[model samples]
Target: MQLEEPQLKPRDYVVVASMLFGLFFGAGNLIFPLHLGQIAGANWLPATLGFLVTAVVLPLLSVLAISATHAEGVYDIGRPLGKWFALTFMVLIHATIGPLFGTPRTATVAFTTGIAPMLPKQWSSAGLLVFSALFFLAAFLLSYKERKITSAIGKVLNPTFLLLLAVVFFVGFLHPFGAPSSAPVTAHYQQAGLLNGFLQGYNTMDALAGLAFGVTVVTAVRGLGLKRDRTVSAVTAKAGVLATAAIGLVYVLLILLGAMSTNYFTASAEGGTAFNQIITYYFGAAGHALLATMLTVTCLTTAVGLVAAFAQDFHKHFPKVSYTAWLAMMSFASFLTANFGLETIIQWSTPMLMFLYPLAMVLIGLSTTSAWFHRAPVVYGFVVAFTVVPALMDMVAAFPAVISKSAVGLAVTHLRDYLPFATVGLGWLVPALIGLALGLTVYAVQQRQHAGAQEME
Candidate 1:
């Protein structure tokens, strides 16, 4: 005789949806779509739609996969693949989404959007060094203190940033820079706008965040009083839809804002520059500090959270290293990486994202369909194994031009060219499908074999 937990109402899911969106929206969410619009230009419609598929659709599915699998954190998300493979997957995910790329990206974005506009060209390098140094240092200090500042980032700074951004969106859209239809479409965009947009969604990094933020969202839902597993999964899926819907809308608006800017300004290095230019246009010289402060504070808060999460997760795994030590290393690495400038950082990040996304996508797909296959390890193993070769080739094919044209890269490129969809940076697709077919075949065979053995017993 147990009392049932009270069911949540629609209003309660709105709060959960907002929480999920807060986790999804960050520096990348702000800039990537703007850059996509600027480059895609007249083709922004298909591009935006494609971006929504990866950015919104995949992430929403990922959140649901988390509940479907009853997993905690990204580590558990990969556990079905086997201990060693799971550990490897977890390491790759956290590294990409943490110290190696995502954390440094936070500082670089803040610098490019906020600080660079206010500084002279010669001072740009020096400015980034100083800013990222102090930025990560402060982050390290705060993370050392049990992440209390997240409260500030959440309760205070996040809302403030959103409010300020909303004002920018309101005014910028109101005036209108130019029509997206009339904007000039770049050559690459003209050729492959949809695929380019899909790739561009990788910049949001939300797919990976979807995996990382899974447990957090689930815990939040549980805290909201949904205790049954089925109920929790339903609530999570509904909440995910609401959250991703909001994100998709924001992405569209950001793209529009960027497309409009083409009327007054030429393309910049990345979306950050465009963002700074747009703010300056609307608010004049005074907008400089306003935009800079806003981006830095928002990005800083994001940086602190990433570093804390990274340090905390790594510390739990390898207790030989102290939390403070892990925190210091990640902060320092991210600061050093930021000095390379935003353009280079983004360029470098693309290759890794190209490789990891397909693998993560496969995992999420498997997790969602776990019940059909009875969570078979052979199925998980075969799919990942088959997908690895093509994924690696796609990654190598996307290396920096210097490396990409080098002998090793060229060899990999030749191999990748043989794979379908290779041209659009998704050469892994056919291979992944083939892998799925093989895994299912093996899973079905195993099920029949076990059934026969049971009859004999």
Candidate 2:
């Protein structure tokens, strides 16, 4: 079947970039990284750079990968595995970004930043549950008309949030309370700060979300009446570059603010405490209250959008279910998770990212390489096999307690001794290379066979 192609427009780099940046720079994207910087102190710059590479660069590649390949969507990008593989990939994307991580995180962090301190100590969890439900219901209402609301939010609310954040960070930097110190909370944490910070950026998970957003963006552009293939790809690329640049700038600014916060704040404050303290130190109680309101609104809006998008996607997969039913299920899950508190949520989420990030990276790598290999399965097989091992090691290392309790943990410990570079979370690098070599060798032999057959014919 022949398909009508999508057309493009004279790219508006600023608008596209602004949209991309707005999409990526959710609440955690702004606050947590800064906290990481404050704690890392002198180590903040390196750690921040590493964080940006993963948080910023990987996400950009994800968008670029989709634009360059022109896959129908993320599923098409994983097509060598066939339909079910694509479905599973889709499910993972939804699960990762929905109730499992993203949705709950927005609620939890919002409460921490906006609601917790104001609540009587005992009423906090109950308050969070009630508040999150109301917040998500509002999200549902907004989601009913997502495009208009999202576009409006992008144009108005997003810029205001950014402005407020910029003011907070800039002011904090100008009058930092404590000097930047090399001393971190611990030696191991300090040594691993950059890597940890890099991985933490995964919580933004725009890379995974990009797999879906790319298709959405393409569709939006098409609706604008651009219907050519090259235009679609070009527009996608332009939009991606614009978005990533904004995200990178915000991350760098926040990290600097984090480092500078050390000049006023101390080690006892980390995570949310550092965040609140920095704002209060610079802006006084009124400033803190205003910023808190902005944060609550920002985080709540993000939560609603995430939940609505996920619920719509979920309903598509399970057509028997009503959107309302699914939204309720997701909202309930998010509500329960919010009670776990922000710090606990952050701790638990680490291993999942370690496990998922490498797989996501491989998908991005292969999708981008599809043209070079003519969409070969051989390359995919090798990369997946090689990368899975190291990613598993990294996941276990990040959560030793998880391994210590299960039979799987025992198996991993035994394997670690024989695995080269296993202690360093790089056990998979060698295996991946070997797999690539084997695949290339096989491809060469197959090509020769085809050449001989063609010559004979």
Candidate 3:
């Protein structure tokens, strides 16, 4: 007789949900929505809805997709794409979320929002360097034990982060700076508010993180004594839903705060700066301390989670290196990158994200719906191939002005003119759909041929 695995209780579910929320919510989460609200102006409602689709809904779906597929990690999620593709995709996702961009970003955001405002002008650069070192050191120590990440973040850091944000939300909302401006919406936001908001939400990069973080979530679920795949997936899905709800609520509140502050403040070029200004406006000197503490804690939790996830995944692939070594190495790299500052990181990352987001979305979409096509490899390959063209176009479009003005950029621009939804950064959607149709048709014909051959033999 087979033994049944135990299920998580309600309280356990809350803990897991909080852990997922902490993992997903970080520096981008803090800055993007606020900026969206400021730019969206009177159209903030529709914009917020659009942002929620990619930021909250897709990320939640990513977690469920991983659960449904029983994927051990992103590599497992991409396995139907073949070994080479799977390995490459997994490496890119991990590196983006780990030391290359996302991890370093957490430290930069913390410094800008928390530490920089308090420092004298001359001291800011040195302060950032020192701050980054300490930040990554703490992250390295915290992430040294992967097994403890869930409890450490979910029970301790998450609640503390929430409490701080709650104070900011309560004070800001209760004492409004000013109503949302009746001023004209930004040029891009005026008409295509939903599309622009959707694109902006991609900056959060949670969907990609979702693929990598799923392993940690699954491991944590099993650690709680749930052994069956069905039970584990069910718990993971429920936890994901709960976490998304929390994240959505926070985003809405932040957007509202941003909208209300629009009249009193001119938008800063950087969202982090605008956010810092909002807190200072309402809470005065004390607000700086509050914002600083909140930013540091939230960024720290996210850094630890990302580093832990990356190290755990890489360690599985290269057991000889050990998890501790990978963790230390990633922490060092992130520290080095963080000193480059937030704006430079964002500029450098945008083009890469333009390419990667669509591919990540396609993989997540296929993983969730794989059962419908009987897990056909051709289906995965075709869709990914079709998606790449538009993704590359988006990368060119997002390239720096100097590059975009070059011969290759001019060629890409002309090509993009013919692609559907190219202007909205969704040129990949049509190709992806067509690829799915062709792949399914080819798969059906091949199956029929194989069946007929077997019968004749």
Q: What residue runs in model 3 are displaced by over 4 Å at the alpha carbon?
A: 181-184, 453-457
Q: Which residue runs does candidate 1 get wrong by more than 4 Å?
A: 1-16, 141-150, 215-238, 320-325
| CA RMSD of each candidate after superposition | 2.8, 3.3, 1.5
Index of the highest-TM-score prediction: 3
Top candidate (lDDT): 3
Per-residue CA lDDT of model 3 for 177-217, tens digit only, reads: 77765633677778888888898889898999999898789
The lDDT ranking, best first, is: 3, 1, 2
What is the per-residue lDDT of model 2 for residues 91-174, given as tens digits with 9 covering 90 to 100? 777676667777777777777776677779899878877877777666666555434443544566567777787787667667
Backbone clashes in each candidate structure, one number apiece? Answer: 0, 14, 0
lDDT of each: 0.80, 0.69, 0.87
Better of 2 and 3 by lDDT: 3
Model 1 alpha-carbon miss at residue 204, Å = 1.9
Tens digit of per-residue lDDT, candidate 1, span 1-457: 6548886887777767765676677788888888888888888888898899899888887887887887756777788877777778878887887777888888888887888877899998888899989999887876676534434444555667778888988898788987878888888789778878988888888888788766556656676666777777788888888878988998999888787677678877678778878888899998999888777766766676577666666776778999889889989888888888777887888888988898888899988899898788888888888888888998888889898999999998998898888887878888888888998998888889999999999
lDDT of 2: 0.69
User: How does each model score on TM-score?
Assistant: 0.90, 0.87, 0.97
